[model samples]
Target chain A: MTVTPHELLAQMASTFRHEIGPAVDEPFAKTQAFMAAVILSKLAGQLQAAEADAQAAGDERRAVVAALRARLGSACPARLGDALTDLGHDGSDAAWSRLVGSLYAERDGLGADEFDALLGVVRSALRARLDRALAYAS
Target chain B: MTDAAAPVETRIAGYLAGKLGADDLRLRDVQRIAVGWSHETWLLDASWTADGVQHERGFCVRRDPGNALLREMSDLGVQFDVLRALEATPVPTPRAYFFEPGVDVLGAPFLVMEKVAGVCPSPWGSDGRRFYEAAAGRGVLPGSFTDALVAIHNVDWRAAGLDFLGVPALGTDFAAREIAKWRSLIDATGIQPDPVLTDLICWLEANVPSTDRLVLVHGAYRTGNLLIDDDRVSAVLDWETEVIGDPMYDVAYVLSELNRERTELLSNIVERDAFRRRYEQGTGIEIDDDACRYYQLLYAMRSAAFWMSATGLFASGRNTDLRLARTAWSIPVVLDNAARALGY
Candidate 1:
């Protein structure tokens, strides 16, 4: 049996959007059908982009970690260092969350200028990641 | 006595008959309305006779689906109490009739109240926007909208027994408490914490503003949440997130760009300066732009929490509504906006 998930999803998306949703009479039901189409289409995009997104994410993660490391130098708080490892070893959404928390927690110690400098690096990487997520969502 | 085997209309008719002590009670126009994500609302006309007198009334029923968005936060029973408390107040709300806390009746907990006469056009739709724009030119609804909000903010919470909504301490406790509430919701939804969200939350905490006065704050106040009749706000609806907190919380909601579309008019109805002048005059509270800015970010967090809860409901298979499923995309969208607002 041939397994084509993307084709199946695209078919369902089109069916829901063009056929099922328009055919429905009830307001909520029609909305639900249209929303199903939207979700399915997004899912298709996300599944297709998974590999490329992962590669881009990995490259960005490594760059962000290196930048943060270079900025931190001797000033890297233990909590922040732990957060930095999640970028390399763990590589999860939660890694950046933890890094952000640590950055704010250690802000007083790092002082205003250094904290702002490090945050700029994190923001660039975050923007790129958000852009990728947005590409698949719409 | 009614059973689940009966259709919803029959069961509700039977239940209302018993409640009203009239055996011949009947319901008409028993249609579900798209009111809010947290509840299944039905607007119906119920009629019966007692003591040789005829009676007719429109009823609004809000039913909790158990797995609706922010299920942990919004309680229909509390809403019933809140409505009853507002009956004599300046706030134009539906009179509370009954609160069914058990599942034996409607298959879920629900509240039935007077269905106030109004048109609650959705702010997101073009038709609705045109309705508001026309109403704005006519100029009655704009003033009516501001007056409705003023009444809500100026309501005496303590005297009106609304203190049950909890009171935050004098300082930045309101902001901290709000942050804690939304953060807990985000954690409960089990959405993987995003860096932008974390950054926004951290910024919100560090810049927590002190509130001088605690007034009843309608957490999500805007045009769509209002019900209009004859160019006046006949009823202030969507009473899900009312709180005994800073008035600026609601003010910030009014000032939020999230509520309006491409229109320069705030909420697609009222002029911003006109609203501010009217609101400040009515509430006796100075308009704090800085506090409004702060609460705007807090609202961003709250908005993210809503999308997370909605997507969680769909993902867990607890809800089959595709609208909930579609909101999964909104999480990233809201976070992106929040990140931009935080200068990310």
Candidate 2:
């Protein structure tokens, strides 16, 4: 852990691509080695931004969930309301995912206007998250 | 893993000799082809002497790699059976020969079939796109692509002994079944929940479309799955995901933008109007636009399931193929597409 993780990844990638890849004889095996090197290089490039992005995304998700819950109020399905409450103020990625699933799964029985309103609110937040993700991924 | 000292060639020759009833069977020039993510395909030349006559043939042996991309869903035996059933039809397929389901034979199940001679251009890579671009101008390949898919959709799967693949009964069973199938695979991944995927699944379940007609559906019908020879579709390969479902499932695949790159042409091979006209005329079934749209979303979900399973396999150390590791990036990319498809 002492060495910069990105530097270590860059070195490993270089070894795989420049040294180990050339020595592999089998075509498929050779492709695997080179592809592993490419993935490592990608990891090296993305390492610096990963933690900060996760934190930011978490904050945005909690805000969105709170806004949606206030709008739902007593209309919220008991199961979904409980799931969201369990995530507390700072929701993990997996919990957010589960909450989304719960929300959609409960959408059918809701009145058309209520469902549309809920969807609009959720979609806006989803789009925001997606934009940030795409930017980071690029 | 196979015994390296004896060689796969020796093992193959031995297997063929027992089945062929010839002691002098010879396997020549065995080479593993780097295609098919789920199965290992080996191309080899086989020769034998029987009744004082020499017989030679080229064969492809597809073996289960134990931890393939879609290991839980695909079966080598089922593929063999499907090929056997299709042999009597006009559907372009390689003739499957021997099938072994037990892992005792070569440490895994495998199926030996006639190696259809053709080139399967990858739909993703630049060179593959160029191959289709050139072939599109030639005119013959595009027509052949349309005709081959039509042949598959026109087949009477029930009469052809393909009922072994369960038939989805009445109304929206087909759509529901497909969603359930993929959901099972998602559950198998044992990864953290994906909210977008869960929402997509709910949406799919809520809006299941009614199936007007059922036929033999090639689950992943596209430019990459077809084998081309002499500028014509020589064979339709990759029967692993074939199912008895709505014809629109296959149509949606051809219609999806995933198969095309920098080209307005469908599958980067045929013009859209041309493909639609030919398919409608050949199959005599009007293109149901709504049904196709629904199946397109289903395809997106299926694609997401594939990436999740692939990434999970790598993370769990079930398999170390770099392709699986690389799929980790594809998971979000596909989920993003699915989210857009759901209008989120």
Candidate 3:
């Protein structure tokens, strides 16, 4: 644990890309080594921001779910409302994912204007989460 | 154990002997070709003496990799059937010889076909772009590219016994079926839920397009999938995704920006106007822009499914290939593209 996983991966990736990859003769094998290096490097980058991204995403999900619950008032489906109410300040990723799926499933049943409004907020947050997830993605 | 020890060249020779019924059957130039993502392709030269006549031919064998990128969707037997059925048609394709169902010979199911002489330029690579550019200036390759696609669209699949690829019943059935097909694949990955991907899927389902005409759709019709010889499309390779669906599906692929590298030409070869004109003239089906837009979005979703399955396979230890691991990075990238297409 002394050498952090990201640091170790970064060193290994550098070795692979600079040392092992150049010496590999076979075209396919060389490409494989290079790709392995790329994956390791990207994983290292992801590790740097992963925790912060997950926290930001969790906060956004909680905020959006809370707002949706308040917007629906008594009209909210008990199944979804109960799930939303159960989310703590720091909601786990799984609960948020399930709530998102439920929202998508129930979107068609809502009035067109309501559906559009809910979708707008959810999609904006979804975009932020995706952007963070793909920050280092090729 | 004994069979595993025996060289694949030896078994291939024996298999060819049985198929050709010739004496002194031999295989030469037995080399593996690393190109396709789904199949283990091998290039070999086969020779045999029949009635004191010497005959030699080049062949390519595509063997299933057991857990290929599109394992659930690809069928080597179906590809062989398609090639065999296309032999009488005008469409350019490799001449398929035999399909081996048993794994004893080569460790997996394989299809043997005549190795069409040609080079397939990679669509995104600089060298490939240069090759296509040089060929485009010559003008023959671009025309051949369109002509080959036209031939596929013009093929009477029902008459050619390709109806086994289920025919969609009514309007929007093709789009709906395609969406469902990729959705099932995404579901199979068991990856964490992606709201963007889920939204894209729902939107595709709700906006399914109506299609009155059905033709053979080469699902991944693009620059890299075509074989070029003498500045002409010698063969349309990669038959794994062929289906009986809308022709515009193929057209939309040519139009997609994913297949080009900083090039304005469709597929980085044919001029956009010329391709549309020639395709319409040959197939007699007008290019529908609205349907094409929808199919392009479907293509984006399909691409996301592919990357998700790829990454999931690597993450779950179903495959150890570095290429599969690399695909994990593309999942979010492709999903973002789909979100943009959905106007997110």
Of candidates 3 and 2, the better by DockQ: 3
Top candidate, metric lDDT:
1
lDDT (Cα, 0-100) at B127 in candidate 2: 95
Model 2: CAPRI class: medium
Docking quality tier of model 1: medium
How well is each residue in A52-121 modelled by candidate 1, as lDDT tens digits?
Answer: 9989989989999998898788778999998998777766878888898899999999899988999889
The parts of candidate 1 lying over 4 Å away from their true place are A1-8, A22-29
lDDT of 2 by residue, B1-344 (tens): 33445767788788887788778998888898756467888999889997788999989999998888888989999999999999999999999999988765577899999988899989789999899999999899989999999999999898899999999886899999999999999889987646666777778988999987889999998888888999988889988788898999999989988889899989999998899999999999888889889999899889989988998898898887788878777766777888888887
lDDT of 3 at B261: 86
What residue pairs are clashing in model 1?
none
Question: Could you tell me the lDDT of residue B93 within candidate 3?
Answer: 95
Please provide, for model 1 over B1-344, each residue's C-alpha lDDT reduced to its tens digit, 9 standing for 90 to 100.
46899988888898899899897898888888764476888999989997878999999988898887888888999999999989879999989999999999999999999998889998999999999999999989989999998998888888999888899998899999999989999999987977888889999998999987998888888998888999999998878888888888999989889999879899999999999999889988999999998999899899888988988888888888888888878878888888887787
Q: Individual DockQ of the candidates?
A: 0.75, 0.55, 0.61
Residue B237 of model 3 has an lDDT of 91
| Best-to-worst ranking by TM-score | 1, 3, 2
Name the regions of candidate 2 deviating beyond 4 angstroms. A1-4, A7-30, A136-138, B1-5
Residue A85's lDDT within candidate 2 is 80
Candidate achieving the largest TM-score: 1
lDDT of each: 0.88, 0.84, 0.85
